[model samples]
Target: MDITSQKSAEEASGRYCGILAHPTSFPSPYGIGDLGKGAFDFIDFLKKSGQSLWQLLPTGPTGFGNSPYQLFSAFAGQPLLISPDRLRESDLLKKDDFLDIPYFPRDSVDYGAVIKFKTKLLRKAFSNFQKMNNADLCAEYDVFCEKHSFWLEDYTLFMAAKEAHNGIEWLSWEDSLALLSPSGKAAWKAKLASETDYHAFVQFIFYKQWFELKEYANSNGIRIIGDIPIFAALDSADVWACRELFNLDSKGFPVSVAGVPPDYFSTTGQLWGNPLYDWDFHRNDCYSWWISRVRHQLELYDFVRIDHFRGFEAYWSIPFGSTTAENGHWVKGPGKELFLALEKELGRNLPIIAEDLGVITPEVDDLRDSFHFPGMKVLQFAFTDGRDNTLMPHYFKSNCVCYTGTHDNDTTLGWYGGLDTRTQDWVRRYMNTGGSLINWAFIRTALGSVAKYAIIPLQDVLSLGSESRMNTPGTRDGNWVWRYYQKDLSAELASHMKQLTELYGRHPETSVWHEQSGFATLNSRGPQS
Candidate 1:
């Protein structure tokens, strides 16, 4: 189907609602949320809450700072998220494997502890797999390896190299390994074959478990939205395996890096420090690398949201060692040519959402609108100026996606609490509600918007404070670790969400009384036809 036809299909479905929460934030006893029962249960919660979508952060293995945006491999899954329970069921693990479960904090991920515990368990599982020589499972693993070998082989080898060098970055390794000396490469590959295979086996397990969980979500009317960062990490398998696709020096150092210019959030600007793409090279190959990247991500999600969508039109390039993004300048990107190639290869029915936020220029808007991709709007930004209606619900367009607040922002309750008396009073007047229910006030407005889709952070839905914020941009620590207890997804909360969704036409009017929804008929209030 063409883009117009695909968009019409989405519009015909009417407004849909979603919850923004990463899988790591799911409550679990085993240190972090894994692709296990908790994941399935979360899908069930989304269904109960009248949510049709579940948007999550990237699933890739995080690197140095433990940020998902800066991943080890864009194509590999997070091994730490592999479920031990699932492994045990497959006989790849036994109860004894977890006899010394580490003390992981319940409220937030102690990434250090979780990594140690999960790594030990995963290594043991790999050992058991080899000892048992489980032919059927081994065959499945081999098939998975062969299917993804194009990228998986390089990623596994990269991981093995990282381990061999005591977790040092690739470019900093010895001359032979760093420069890819032919003889040294052969010798090192032979030496690290076992370790590399171990990484490959872990990825096989990740996809196995994730496929199951994603199947469960789809079965229950929940679609997953996955994020894809615009830039590749300088220390990533992508930069290593596809060197020509990035602007890197001969020794693998980035020639220039990625970042955003100074804005309301920062004076020096936010320096992301990831390697910038060599758009000319990508275009020379008809964007094959980008097409493959998007294709791989599409397989993992129902809808793939391209982070920093504006970068396609132009990107901010900072000097390699710049301390801040203030010195960066905008450079023209692949723009229409790249996306046009993607559409030709992947078909125009691509289920994509552009995260068209930040200092958006008319060119960025043109690019996003040209492809019929849904741009995003956050309600929290609406009242920044009392007269700014662009962010207001009443001015929202049907082709967009609306949010009360995103993972980058504080929870609605926390944001309201931070505002001065004047701003707080303005918020109250705008929403036409008292200060007591600010969270729901923002949520209701989002659902009531003309935007075809509305998403609320799990924090806002639960009325959490700043302490539960998932991420705070520009900060290095105390982010992406928030976890919510199962107790927080109460029956009352689900019912309230269902009622609001029904009242605002975000959900099917008749579905409110469906026993599966766990809510009685809300006949008193329903959106007019």
Candidate 2:
């Protein structure tokens, strides 16, 4: 491992606990969570709760379905997350911009309204910036554009062209643009230079604000853990700009797509219509694209959790026109060769957490273990099977990260409430606790387990029910809209969480709060209620 990778590994090695909450869940008045006071307040809450980490969902710009995993560009920060207050602070916006702010719900994001409002403000900010004469800021923007031109130039042009074509899919555009012909690219660049620059300007502001927030979190001793999905959406800048890297045909239609086969969960299975990677081509190119992707993610986060990590060893590929994933077949993936190439360029001992869920094979396990990357264990999956279930806390290893539930799963209380009586009884018997306040029971169990890291979703901490769930798999609507209010982060709640965290030896360094709070000693049973 190089110095950077070694430092990251060291940071991730200790026993610690954190809340798993996305930035969008942070409370704000601008109809969405942003890198404003709400975000800084969240970091302060983490510190007061004795947390050293803050795990997040993918921060990329959401595309169709308003899902972060389905992004416009894997390398771009979500413009929606840009704080209007921060813009005003930078003199890019003024107080008049907030005069017509809409009334947004405190508990959920109305994405449609939020998008329209934020888009207008962002455009205004860009226009204000263009009319300004600030040499320092302009120079900084120029540096950012030049530094990221490898992906920025293509991304901006793609966005501009998509806008020009009334937001239709690239394949439906003129053949020259759809195919990304050299002549067509040059002509479009010249024709849409101003619009493309506007998009680039948006990125510059997004990154400037995002990095400031990241730095604040780090300075507060809280490391951010970001997510990176394994597959890119077919309607993404990635597939639109680099066609040869994907399983697309001459007419830019997918030859085969990505999906998993039928399981007990559903008879037809899940058909995720993402274009599969042309692994042979990637390998021949030394996995340059994958390397750049990983490098960019590392820059945006202290540690990255690669979603659907098992796909690295092998993935399920389905025919393009398949209605369901039942007809998909398992195909070999790039495996260690890709990671080896990444390590050669980025460094070894990469700070990666593998989402090793689903039907993982020995090959996948081998690939994950080869790099000593930690796999995840969701506690909610433990009691569903039997005592021998690997997800049980007793079966957990110190090298793994544990969670009560992920963004895809219901809140811990909701999951427990819906469980069959037999399983519910088993859960109570295993944890040796009454069924009341089951969310806290799960949180305590996770923290006390041998897993090196335990992450409890904020909903579980707040004892929220199904309505507060972040997402539900295999569903299209009513997802990724959950938000929390400022009042939800009560001081008493923080104190309770801190007590449990310290009791489990998950707090960083010596616990002055535990000592001052009259705890008998470390790991003592100190007020479990």
Best by lDDT: 2
Model 2 spans > 4 angstroms off: 1-3, 263-265, 511-517, 520-529
State the lDDT of candidate 2 residue by residue for 1-529, as single tens digits.
Answer: 5634655657655687898999898999988898899999999999998898899999988877889888888898898999999999999999998899989998899999999999999999999999999999999999999999989999999899999998887889988888887888999999999999989998998899889989999888888899999999888889999989998989889999987777534568878789999988998898999988988888888889999998889899999998889888899898998888988998888889999988888999899999888899999888767789888898888889999999989998899989989889999898777878788888889998998889989998888899999988777999999999998888867877787877788888643344475455432222233
Best by TM-score: 2
Q: How many residue pairs clash in each candidate at the backbone level? A: 0, 0
RMSD of 1: 3.5
Off by over 4 Å in 1: 1-12, 181-184, 508-529
Looking at model 1, which ten-residue stretch has the lowest summed lDDT?
520-529
lDDT of 1 by residue, 84-128 (tens): 888999998898887888788888999989988889889999999
**Candidate 1 at residue 282, lDDT?**
84
- The global C-alpha lDDT for each of the candidates, from Candidate 1 onward, is 0.85, 0.87
Q: Candidate 1's C-alpha lDDT?
A: 0.85
